[model samples]
Target: MRSIWNGAVSFGLISIPIKLVNATENHSVAFRQIHIEDGSRIRHRKVCEVEDREVTTAEIGRAYEDADGTMIPITDEDLASLPIPTARTIEIVAFVPAYRIDPLQMDAAYYLAANGVPAAKPYTLLREALRRSHKVAVAKFALRGRERLGMLRVVDDVIVMHGLLWPDEIRAPDGVAPEAGVTVRSKELDLADVLMETLGEVDLADLHDDYREAVEELVAAKASGGEAPSAPVADRTGRKVIDLMSALENSVRQARVARGEAGSADVGADADADVKPLRRTAARKRSEAASEPPPSRKKPARKTAAKTTAAGGAAKKTATKTVAKKAASEAKKSAPRRRASA
Candidate 1:
């Protein structure tokens, strides 16, 4: 790959000549502006306001606009005269733990390649030192026209540099979090933990850009003069969830189903409600009563009485399991009742 910048890394008295190349690339579909009526391509022209005519790149110059709306012309010669030591060198200012660098300050990333055969020793040495120390080098370098802060760390066998915004550039997250009045229940937190565990970790390499793929497919269909491909519409029930506990429980079950752990049972009729959230509402009590088997009126025969005893034992066992599952929910609701009584 072609390098964007050529510079030497200044580490104390040692200097390693290196080339900087971008670490990431954009792969997105581009669209051009066109005249809808004439089906003609649209192009923009640059014109000077004073001259009122089109201008070439050679005629253009850089300028700084003041807050008072005055334009100050800045020539290339004027910038070149500036005394900046980091103009062509990546100067290592300090070494710091990787966690010390705020993620919010992270910007563009680049790989530092050894510029020449002689520079390989120092490059490898720096990479090994950074790896053994478990730290990153804070650096200052000039690229394009401005000086930037960077973090140097080892990625595999290569030394990579990540551009970072200055601490002052990061905005304070004032009024960004949720209101203080909102509260999360312990039951809700438990359900959220289960949901997290169900989803678990994912391999980033296994993921792909679905939107980009869809756009590419659309473009291909248009180019071939064929009807655009259709995708199956997702079933979206326009339901607004009012209960946080119910939502979290449902989310966990859905995540488990998506991971294909419970086979088809999760989406089937006989799926177990082992982790069901129990709410102490009037509607819930009514629903629980409705689900229970009603009492039989007729007296039982001797043989039937034995069967009835066995059924009673089984019912007691099931009730015990239910109580155990609802223990936390019951404790939470009973606390208020006890307080009221006291």
Candidate 2:
């Protein structure tokens, strides 16, 4: 949560004092080099190629190679004093629609928080203004001794500043003509649109870094002297050669099923219908049995026999109920005329 930089955001005469906090964090597994045989730590050295000796930090200087193969050395102070001005202020030059900028131009993002109560007003104003206009402000500032171009946009009522890649830094795709054209049939386009319709809404929370998780697991296994885990096998069977019209129909059906507009039986009618209910019944029984307390193994046969005998006795009693009721009524009628035999 530490602020990477503290500066003011300037737009015309308004300036908002704010601190920049890094928006992202590295979650990759880190490792150190070690001797495989002895498990000894390995250290790197800074060696000078010409002298054939190790050099200290003080001996190192920045150098640029000239076109004539001459080495031009420069000190840190000289590089700092270069013609490029390192402005501490994020000076917004222009505002443009957010969608107009390509996502690839974004290098890094940071959170901009107002430093004090006096700065909060301008910060809020800029954020609300950006949201209302549906645009982001293109700005420039200096960080880590380099002049950086950035985009300021509102995210969840907070100003999010993103460092942008310079136009020169982004290379155009090579070996291809910019004016290349390809023809698409109407049927193919229609099918493509149907396929796109099957896709659900984008949910950012559903996305996860599977590769990073696998790498971390591998590292942990190796550290415990275990073999590396196997890579996941991909299923490549049942590849289809699509007929445009048929594919479009199938895609529409799938989309309807996904949205619960069509029943399961209506969607996959030809597939084994008996298998689904049977599987569901088996799963339900298994779940019920799993929830119940396990029967005691001790004297299990005796317990079963006792339960059976009790059920038989109850059945016999119900069968003789009419005779027993008639006998009881006769006894009551006779006993009313006699005195108690005290």
Candidate 3:
């Protein structure tokens, strides 16, 4: 990782030499605009409306419009003469409870690492102190020609500085009217809870970028002599929305059936197909044993011999036995298992 800024973090008379490294990285694929006809790259030009033509970089000037609608041009020297203070250091002003800050105020995060010289003692002290107090240090620093407000907190034994939004930047919840006189049935709420329970454990690793996968698949298909796929058609059925209570009940029923908690007619059909041959073969063996004289008690091995013959007669007998035993054990445990949905 490259350091975005290099400066010291100051508090009182103590200053720690540190460098700021960006904590987040984006893996998104990038593309540029091109001429569709000839597949030629496209470029943007800087044009001046006053001159009605493209202008060079050096010929451009910065100006601000005043209340009187007059454009006032400012030079680099004039901007430098302004009373704005430039402090490159991250100065901690005060410590506040971390929970008091809204998550939406957080803009960017950067890791602070000590430059060359060991900062182990001070770093550890600051990190442990913040962790114990559950507070974050509000700090100010200069970056990209402007002073910014930031929060300094310890995460995973390292100090990180996160940029914050100004108070005015946060939008107020005004005009967001609440639902009045709306009633919810108790049974509907209970059914919603049951549906949530049927969803088993969440594994973030299982989530993937389906769009990227689809793009790759399309590319492969095109390479294999297939035409490029068309864009997806939007769903415009215009069907009426179902009642919330009924929807919740149906969702609960579906979840239960998916988790094998409730057996459906389809499940019964599958179960019957799986056990039909086993039942028929077992009955036939029993009938044959009954036709023959009952094995004498002196030969107890006859029972074992009958069982072995019955097992061998079934197709994939060993595999079926193993699978049946495993299923039985899993059913006895009664814990929910997550399976990928088709």
Per-model TM-score, in order, reads 0.77, 0.63, 0.63
Mark the regions of model 2 whose C-alpha exceeds 4 Å error after superposition: 32-43, 82-85, 174-181, 225-228, 235-342
Model 2 error, position 105 (Å): 1.8
Model 2 Cα lDDT, one tens digit per residue, 1-342 = 899888899988898899999999988777799999998999999999899999999988878899998999877787557765335688898999988778889989999999989998888999899999999999988887578889999889789999998888888878766566856554445445545755657789989999999998898898899998998787535435345455455556667677887787767554222212112234445555666888878798889999999999998998799789999999998795665643
lDDT of each: 0.87, 0.79, 0.74
Q: Which ranges of candidate 3 are over 4 A from the true structure?
A: 48-63, 68-86, 216-225, 229-241, 256-342
**Span of ten consecutive residues with least summed lDDT in model 3:** 271-280
Q: Which candidate number would show the highest TM-score if scored against the true structure?
A: 1
lDDT of 1 by residue, 284-338 (tens): 4555566678876555576689899999999999999998979978899999999
Clashing pairs in 2: none
Task: For model 1, name the residue pairs that clash.
Answer: none
TM-score order of candidates, top first: 1, 2, 3
Instruction: Kindly give the number of clashing pairs for every candidate.
Output: 0, 0, 0
- Tens digits of per-residue lDDT, candidate 3, 211-257, equal 77778777778779888777789663532335665555555555667
What is the lDDT, from 0 to 100, of the residue 103 in candidate 3?
93
